[model samples]
Target: MKITPLALAITLICVLAVLAGTTAPAVASDAGGIVGGIFGALIGTVREGEARNDWQKVNREVKTCLSKRINVSIGQLVQKAIDPTDPRLRPYMQACEQQVAEANAQLQQERRIAGLRREQEEAAKEAAAVRNAHARAQKVARHRELIAKYGAKIASDIEARRVRIGMTKEATIAAIGKPNSREVVPPSNELWSYGTKRIAFTNGKVTYVGN
Candidate 1:
């Protein structure tokens, strides 16, 4: 068979059309992959953002709950301390108040931790060492005074206060007068020492006391 120019041109056009049609789906598939990648990235970004927000919200709520508990404990300690009818129990009550103050101060320090976490989570590493040193120094001073003033009573009261660790410093002071001495716990900016008991304060609130 002899081919004419018109026939050749016609055959070329048909061949091109078939090739284009055959490859159309593959082209569409590649384009689809790009679009899917973009969509996936967007979804992941949204989910990560939401997770961060939820974490922060939960942390705040937990702190608030802890604060309320600390306050209630302090109030109870004050009530117990003021009841002169139980003179034997007064010392223990005073200790409880001090523990509460200490706890409140610790909580305040934790609030600082939270803030630091928000700014730079790594800050906790440095902050922890500083905090520990402060706690140790305060503990030493508190133990010395307790040994000097209350003697055996200090140990007994401390044990009792452990059972009731959420008293306020104000109530403790009201019950036992001013502290014989006071010292600051580092990093937390809380006070600690011994007079009649161990006490801790944070943001002017009593959070822990110990006999």
Candidate 2:
């Protein structure tokens, strides 16, 4: 008597159909035989494993409803049409109601999770934009400071690609802005490369410069 989402849907449909019938026949005595057509229609709407609609959340409450109303399985409904006055019908209806409620709760939980995920993605984007803007501002400020100290001659050296042996590391950086890479060449000697050009520093003073 597990009212799955599919079963819940079928039961809901069948209950509506039955109530609509005032004096419908209970068995397969005539062409309109019980809930057989109703079951068949539900089955036809999907393949064997898929749910017909979005009522998939009814699966969770198997403990609360299915543990008690165990015998009212899906296919058995065809053999006899439900009677409003029948002794078994009340429990079946109660179980169906519980399944519907559980399904609705599950749907709400999914929507909440989706909303939170979107909010997190938006926050991450804003943080990255702020970081990028700060970095750009810092670089611009450093360029202005370098130009103020060394004047237009250092700016021309930076633009025309030049590094001299007497320039300090900071002056070299002011001349070239920054290298693509730097490395130690043993015995406290540092080598900074800018494009194909290389500058060697020893004891914090430029020792060798070449392209």
Candidate 3:
């Protein structure tokens, strides 16, 4: 009286197989087999979907219990499969806080050390600047003394970086800073090379200046 979906599907398959030139007995057997296999596959898929839904429901329940700090679900402690009970949250949090505090303290100490190093470097630079200033003041005093000793014309010539015959070795050095190389010739003569130029000195007095 009541034709189910499975019965209807089998009847349609049988009609199609018969129209396709299959014998009635062969069509009946092949249609039955095909319909049975399709139904079996559909049933298996439904059971798999139901099992997945049940797992998701259980997982949500476990998460809800943990969020509420219930610490247990379904009359049993449902936690991660690994390390189910070791290292509870409160102790773990305390340990984590201590580690954070220690890290902050170490960072502060390193900052202080870096600040001290910068201060030392600044102090060293200041000390070097002071020494350079004192040396410059001494040079000014010597230059003034030289101007008073030798006439202003000779002092001006030296200050203008000129090398002249009869100029003392000290005057020549003050005029042109220092020579690149110095060699002593035989019998107390000195030859000073300044890049492409050369100066010859005898008895501490300049005798010749030429390139």
Candidate 4:
């Protein structure tokens, strides 16, 4: 089977546990430490090439695992490191366990906050869509009323589907349905802006149209 990073990391922990539990000298992770130096020196005397190869493989696997499972494996290692049979591993185990608990709790809280933020954003989008639909319904109703009142000009224009120089506001509304927005600026010019085209009205009649 292909060796995974977690598998390698777990192997290292197991090795540490075995070494720590033995009657042999304590092993430190640090190379400069007496226990660590002794173990390294012993490996050099026995199948040095094979020992180095195995360590290199384990090291690579651990580095890969660290990228994705740093927090989780660290917590697991700390939890497993507290074996009472190993006096060397006992002192710091309680503190490590507490750190893991706190870290996990904080991570959970952050996820909760993120979930709430997402929910609020979705609700806001849904509310905006609802408001837009309601506005469109009201606009369609208003257009139908206008068409019922002044529909003859619309019918003529529909035959040609064209707006000439002097179409009335009601006829314009019928022909184009409704504009995106209406602007009555600077003495109320009564301009209607409809995506890439603007129509100007004077005395409720189209005076200019620009596209």
Candidate 5:
């Protein structure tokens, strides 16, 4: 059965009371007629669905052990003046206690694994963000270096994608990016074509620009 938070809380209180010498009859009366109270409070809300399911398993297993060994239904135990510390109940209590311990341990291990998974995912996201930031910073630094070398006006022209006569071959190339093709003008010039636009370079400087 699904255990609610309030039910678990009440069970925990009852367990405390039982441990403090509360009689079996009193426990049965207050916490319902459950043998060993299923130790529901021992696990105590470790997680939501899975944890409750584990507690429910413990409850059923303990009650089953009690019913089989004592030959009495859980409901009958509540009406009888059953002693919580009865010698006949010892072996079953020990076995049921082991089950509770195992359930708690399993829940703890699952919680640790989930925490590790979350940490790994967060670390990966942080690493990717750092890489992107570094790439952007490098781009900004490269832009500044180009502006310093070519002067602001030339840089502005490059930014506007304008190629003009008297601009250095390097500067013109920077403005328009790489050309589609380059041709050797027989004597000492270079002809660079950019799709429909063409530029003529003489002695490493642009001499003419045309479509």
Candidate 6:
């Protein structure tokens, strides 16, 4: 229901076509010796406007039909403009129709080229995504292999030390070594801490030992 720019432009073309048809003879007669020139100019203006309108309409129709899975040709639309009933307008119509054909051809060719470029870009992105996924999978596999090689022994050592709490700091230090770091916990009758080395004793026992 809304009148789009294309529709407005088409209306303008139709108005101009009627004006050119009615005024060409008058303008030609008034020009006298320059009648041919005036008529030529009028024909050229009408043809140009018609060609422009045809091109825009063809473009819109092409998009609509393609979206709906219907096929139509630009050339056929141009041919319809060349009405045999209006013999006086034949020359102008022919010229405008030729321009429409040329414009449509150029538009179609450009679209083809654009489609190919988009396809290439999408293919590249897909290839990169596959490569990234493969790389991540390889990394996960390597991590799992390393865990299988060392995780169980580490787990066993940690579990063994878990039960050996209640030793003095000196005794814990003697059994383990110097801790990489230490922290004090306040208020809870217990200092809970762990580090990368030695052992930490809280309330006279080894609470944490790390290697």
Q: After superposition, how far is residue 22 of candidate 1 from its true place, in Å?
A: 57
Q: How do the predictions measure up, each by TM-score?
A: 0.21, 0.40, 0.43, 0.37, 0.43, 0.32
Regions of model 3 farther than 4 Å from truth: 1-88, 156-161, 165-170, 173-196, 200-207
lDDT (10s digit) by residue, model 3, range 56-94: 554343335343564444223322221222355445434
Give the per-residue Cα lDDT of candidate 6 at 98: 69
Q: What is the C-alpha lDDT of each candidate?
A: 0.55, 0.64, 0.71, 0.62, 0.73, 0.54
Q: Could you say which candidate leads in TM-score?
A: 5
Model 5 worst lDDT run, 10 consecutive residues: 42-51
Q: How far in Å is the alpha carbon of 62 misplaced in model 2?
A: 15
Compare candidates 1 and 4 on TM-score and give the better one: 4
Report the lDDT tens digits of candidate 6 across residue range 1-211: 9974455555655655566567778753544435344455556556555754645654453334432332334444334442222465445445555666787899999999999999999999999999999999996775566347436443333334432455555434433444556666553233433443445455656676455
Runs in model 4 deviating more than 4 A are 1-88, 152-163, 169-211
User: TM-score of predicted model 3?
Assistant: 0.43
Worst 10 residues of 6 by lDDT: 61-70
Q: What is the lDDT of residue 169 in candidate 1?
A: 57
Residue 55 of model 4, lDDT score: 34
Residue 124, candidate 3: alpha-carbon lDDT: 100
TM-score of 2: 0.40
Q: Clash pairs of candidate 3? A: none
Which is the winner by TM-score between candidate 1 and candidate 2?
A: 2
TM-score of decoy 5: 0.43
Clashes of 4: 0
Question: What clash count does candidate 2 reach?
Answer: 1
lDDT digits (tens) for residues 1-211 of candidate 5:
9987767766676676665565576655655534334545433333334433433454676767667766887555433434344577778778776876798799999999999999999999999999999999997886788789998788778878898778998898788888899999778899999999889999988999998
Off by over 4 Å in 6: 1-87, 150-211
lDDT of 3 at 3: 71
